[model samples]
Target chain A: MESGTARIAVDLLGGDDAPAVVVDGALRAVRADPDLHLLLVGPAEAAGEVIRALDPAQRARVTVRPVRTVVGMADHPVAARADSTVRGAVHAVRDGAADALVSAGSTGATVTAVALGLGRWPDVRRPALIATLPAVAGPVVLLDVGGSLEPRPATLARHAALGTAYAAVAHAVAAPRVGLLSVGTEAGKGDRARRLADPILAATSLPCDGRYVGLVEGYDVSLGARADVVVTDGFTGNVLLKAIEGAYAMAGGPPTGGGAPRAAALLGVAGTVVVCHGAARPEDVAAGIGLAAHLWRRRATDQVRALLDGTEAGDREERTDRTTDTEVPTS
Target chain B: MESGTARIAVDLLGGDDAPAVVVDGALRAVRADPDLHLLLVGPAEAAGEVIRALDPAQRARVTVRPVRTVVGMADHPVAARADSTVRGAVHAVRDGAADALVSAGSTGATVTAVALGLGRWPDVRRPALIATLPAVAGPVVLLDVGGSLEPRPATLARHAALGTAYAAVAHAVAAPRVGLLSVGTEAGKGDRARRLADPILAATSLPCDGRYVGLVEGYDVSLGARADVVVTDGFTGNVLLKAIEGAYAMAGGPPTGGGAPRAAALLGVAGTVVVCHGAARPEDVAAGIGLAAHLWRRRATDQVRALLDGTEAGDREERTDRTTDTEVPTS
Candidate 1:
C-alpha cells in the first residue's frame, strides 16, 4: 500500500517457461502500477516483446539491461557467478539502478547471486527466504523457505529475529509472536535441531515488541492461531509451503483471503529481493514483481536490518560463535 | 472392506479429552460395525458409560479391562511400562485377546508399548507409523508419521520397504511407486539425510512390485500424482500431516474423498495398531477405531511383515548394520 516510484529489476530469462512468462508478467505489472518501473534483464528480443506490448506512456517506465545468459534450475549455486540474467538483476540493485530485483530462477543461484552482489547483513550468516501466508488470523511469516536448507540452531534463532522484524515492518503486525516450528507444541517434541534451537530462540531477545511463544506445530503455520512468525529450516518450510499449496488445490481452491504465496521476499541481504517459484505462472511472476515494488517502496529491507542490528547489539555477549559456519546456504 | 469379527482394544484414558471422547467413539464404532467388538481398557466408570449407552445386543460385544494407570502426553515413553492403559492394550493384542488396538494417547508411549509387547519384525529396527491420505489419484501412504522421528539412512530405506509392502497388502495398490519426500523432485534437492538416503533407496529392492520413483516434493503426499508411497523422517511426516489437516480446515472443508487422516497405522510391529491424534475428537477416535478394525480384518500386519521378510531376505547383503540405533522412536 506504500505508493511511490519503485524501480524493480526483472529477470526475464528466469523461470521454466522463461522469456514468455516473464514478458507477460512484466507487461501485466507495468500496466497495473503507474509509478512502477521495470529494468528487464534478459535477451533483447524478450525485453522488446514486453516493451512493444505497452503503450507509449507506459513504455516510458520500461528499460532493458539485455543480458542473454541464463541459469537452469539444475545448475549449481556457483553458476550464478556467470554472466546470467539473475546476476545482472542483482548488479542492477547493487549499482542503485533499481530499488529491488525479482527472479524465478534456481533458488540457490538467486540466493547466491544476491548475497554476493548485494552483500548480506553484518550478523546474518545465511539469508532467509521469508514467505508470508495469508492464514485465518492474519499474515503468517514463514522463514528459511528454501534459502538455507540446512541451517544450524544459531541460524534458525537469527532467522527468528529476522522474521519477527519482517512481520512487524513489512506486514504491519503489532507485537508479533514468534514460534519455532516442530512436530508438537510440547517443550521437547521435535528433531535434534529443533530441540537445540528451542532453547536458543527462547533465550534470544526479539525486536519490534515481538515475544517468543515457545514451540508451535504445523497447524500454527496455516491457522495463525498461536504465532504470527513461524520459524523453520528451509527444507521443512519449502516442502510444507508446497504441500499447503497442493492441499488448497485438492480442496477445490484457496480460502476467501488467498492461497499459499508463490513468491517470497529474501531477507538478510543488503537489498530487497523477491523470488518466485521456478515453475511460476505469469501471474506468479507479476506477484513477485509487485512484492518487490511493495518492499522497495516501504524500505522494508533497511528497516528490518536496523531492527536486527538493535536486537543483536542487545544480545552481542551471547553470540560469539554464531557466524562460525557462515555462507553454508544449502538452498 | 474386509468383513470379520475384529476385536479391538480401545484405550479409554487416552487423548486430551480422554474418557469422554473415548467412550463416545467406542459407542459409535460398536454401533457402526456389527462384527466389531471392543475391550475398553481404562477406569471401570468410563467403560460403564460406553456399555450403558449400548442396547442389550450391542452390550454383548463390549467388555471392560480396568487399568487405573494412564500415560499423559507430556510423559516420557517409558511411562507406558508402568501398567498403563496403552500397555494393557498392547498386552491384549500380544495375548490374542484383541485383533488390534486403538489409542489416542501419546504416540511415543503407544509405539514403545507396542514395540515391546508384540515385538518388532526381525529385520525391522524402527516401527513406522503409516498414515494413508486420500489423494487425487489414489491413496498416498506416508510412513514414519510419529514413530522413529529422526531415522537414519538405513532406517528410512527400511521404512521405504515397509511402506511399499503395506501399500500393496493393506491398500491393495499394485506396483506402487515409492518416493523419498524432499524439497524438490530433482536428484540432489534435499538435506544431508535425504542426499544419503536417495541412493540407498534406489539400490534397495522393493517388495510387491514397488519401485523407487526418486525424490518427490510435498505436493505428492496430498495429490498422489507422482507416487503412492512417500517415505520421510517421522519428524517431517508428523508436521506435514498436521499442516495438511490445517490447510484443509483453512479451505473450509476437505475434498469429497476426505482430508488428512487423524489415525495412523503402526507397522513393523507384530500386531495391527492404530494411533489417533493426541487432540482427537470423538469422530476422530471413531475413525481410529474403524481403521484398526479394517487393518485387523485385512490381516495387514501379518501380510506386510511377510512381504518385508521376502524383500529383506533378497537384499540381506547390503543391510548388515541397519539395527545399530534400534529402539529410537522419538515421538
Candidate 2:
C-alpha cells in the first residue's frame, strides 16, 4: 500500500441500495485503510452510520458534508442538479476537501459532475471510463466502458493516448501495446468508425513509448495476449466488460487471478474519480474507494494529462514540418 | 446420435493450421458418430492422410474431392477463386454429395461461398452466423457472430426471428425470450440502430411464441438470465462470443456446463453450414463437424426458414392493415 493520507469523498446515496450499501462499503474502506480519510456527502443519517461503525480513535478520520439530492438512473445525464449528492462529492474534490471521489451512481451523472466540477483536460471532449481486467499477460486496460456511447473517430484517437498513459501511470506497464478492439485482427475488420480510427491511431504518437498493435479481437481484452491496452467505443466496451464478468460467474468461479472488476476509473477529467457499478455490493464499493485512493496517491490523472499534453505538443511540431515538406498527390 | 446418416463436406484447407487440424477433426468426428460421413475437400495428399488413418470399414464413410486453392486470411471475401477449397465444400452440398458443410476458413469467404453455391433464403441479404452459448438458464443463441458487421434495423429484426426459431427448433427452447443486445436494458439506451430496432422487434410477431424482451446487456448473453436468444450486429456478436471464450480460459477452465462455442452455425443459407475458428484445434474442428451433423439431422435450417416465411407473411398482413386503417402523424 502507498504510504500517504488520501482523503476520498464518497457519495452516500448513489446506488440502488443507497445509504445502506454505501454506509457498509464506507465503513469497510475506513477500517481497511488506516491513512484513508472519508468525506461522506449525502444524508446525515447515512454519514452517522459510517461514523458509528468506526472506533472512537478512527472516528476522526471520517467527516460529513450532508446533501439530499440524487441523480436517478432514469434521469437524463445533461441535467446538473445543484443539490445532487454526486455534485457535492465532486465539489469536495475541487475544493480540496477530498483528494479524490467515488460514486456508485448513474455513470453519466458522475462523469458529468466530475467534468463540470474539475473541468476537462484540454482537447478531451469525452472523458473515458477505463476498466482494467486481469489476464494472463498482465492487466489489460480497456477505455470508454461507458463514457461516450457513440464517439467520433477523433475521440477514439484521444482515448488511445489516455489509455496508454493510464496503463503506464496506474499499472506501471512500460511501453504498453495499444490495440483497437475489432471483430478480427485483419485490417478493415471493424465498423466505419473503427476502420477510420485504425489508421489514425497508427499514425498518431502514443504516450509512455506505447506502440499501436493495429487491430485486436475480443480475446485480447480478457487474455491480454495481444495488447496491454484495448480501446473501443463506450457501447462495445461496456457490453464486452459485462459479458466477461457473466462468463466468469457461469464458469462456477473466477480465475485465480480474479474476476472482472465492478469499478472503473474515469479518465480525461482533471480530477481523480472512480465509478462503481450501480448495482454495486459492499465489496464493490470498497474496491471503488480503494481504487480512488490508489489513483489519487499515484497522481494517475495528472501524469496521464501531462503525457497527453506532451504528445499533442509533439504532434503540432510534426504537422508544421510536414506542411513545410512537399505534398504528395491527393487521393 | 440421430439415426439418419449426416454427410458433411469438410474444408480441409480452411484454417490457419489447415489439413492437419481438419484431418484430425474429421477422424475424431467419424469415430464418434457411426452414422456420420465426411466428403473431404482439399489436396489429394491431405485427403489420402485422412483415408489412411481410418479402418477398411470406416473408409467407406470417408470420400475425397480434390481442390488446390486455399483462401488466404487477408484475401477479400468477394474473391471466390475458382479452385478455392471453401467453394469445393459448398459445391459438395449443392451436388447432393453432402448433407451439410463445415469450414474453418475466413468467415467472410465461407459465408460468400455458401451464399453463392446453395443460395441464400429469399430476402436475407446477410445470413447470420449463430453461436449457442451454454448459460445458467439454458442455451443462449447469439446471432450475427460475424456475418453482417453493421446490419440495418430491418436486418436486426430479421435476425431476431431467425434466432427465436433456432432456439426452439434446434435447442427445444419453448417461447424463447428474444432480446436486442445493447449497452443497457432500458429503452433508448443504445446507439441509433438499437434504439430503432427495439420497437420493430417488440411489434414483430415471432414464431414458436417467442417473446421479445427489451434491450439486454452483455450479461444477458453469458448468464442467460434475461433472455434465451440474444441478437446483435455481426461485429459485436463475434467479439462478444470470443471474449466469453477467453474469460472461460482465464478462469482456469470452462464451467461444469461448458464454455462459449468455438464453432458457430451459419443460418439463412439453404443448407446447414458450420464455421469453426480459423485457429481451430482438432477438438474445435470435431465440434464444428458434430454441430453440422446435429443441425442437419434436426432439419434446423429448413424449420427456421419455414418459421421466417410464416412470420414475414404475417408481417405483410399487419402492414396492409395499418395502411388501410390510416397512418398516424409521422414522427
TM-score (0 to 1) of chain B for each candidate? 0.95, 0.97
- Tens digits of per-residue lDDT for model 1 on A52-109? 9899999999999989899998888899999999999999998989999999999999
State how far residue B321 of model 1 sits from its true place (Å): 16
The ten-residue window of minimal lDDT in model 1 chain A covers A322-331
Q: For candidate 1, lDDT tens digit of each residue in B1-331?
A: 4579999999999899999999999999999999999999999999999999999999999998999899998999999989999999998888889999999999999999998898888778889999999899889999989898889998999999999998998789999999999988889999999999999999898999999999999889989999999999998898899989999999999987999999999988888999999999999999999999888878888888788878887677555545543545344
The TM-scores, chain A only, for the candidates as listed are 0.95, 0.97
Among all candidates shown, the one with the greatest TM-score? 2
Q: Once superposed on the true structure, which residue ranges of model 2 sit more than 4 Å away at CA?
A: A321-331, B322-331
The lDDT of model 1 is 0.92
CAPRI quality of model 1: medium
Q: What DockQ does each listed candidate score?
A: 0.74, 0.84
Give every prediction's interface RMSD: 0.7, 0.9
Among all windows of 10 consecutive residues in model 2 chain A, the one with the lowest summed lDDT is A322-331
The TM-score of predicted model 2 comes to 0.98
- Candidate 2: give the TM-score of chain A: 0.97
